[model samples]
Target: MKVEQNADLPKTTHCNKSRRNLTEEEKEARRIRRVLANRESARQTIRRRQ
Candidate 1:
């Protein structure tokens, strides 16, 4: 009986880039949404403790 070993492999490189820009309004909206999400999570934690 005989066994063969395989331990050689090649790595690949990726080069991805973004191609879209956000306007000022869009940026503000994203910031507000994130703040609201965090606030909601904190409220949930306080409710659990009560």
Candidate 2:
């Protein structure tokens, strides 16, 4: 079986056909959720650049 990049994210992220069905609000919400979920990773990445 093929696994996805992020275990925390939904499988829909890898399916463009399904993604196209999402409303704008849903897309925005999904982006927000992804950002929220990656807060610690984002902080670490920023810190590494310093």
Best by lDDT: 2
Question: What TM-score, over all chains together, does every model reach?
Answer: 0.56, 0.42
* Residue pairs whose backbone atoms clash in candidate 2: none
- Which stretches of candidate 2 lie above 4 Å from their native place? 1-8, 11-20, 41-50
TM-score of 1: 0.56
lDDT of candidate 2 at residue 17, scale 0 to 100: 69
**Inter-residue clash pairs, candidate 1:** none
Model 2 per-residue lDDT tens digits across residues 1-50: 22233635666756766445768897787787666657767676898999
Q: What is the lDDT of residue 14 in candidate 1?
A: 46
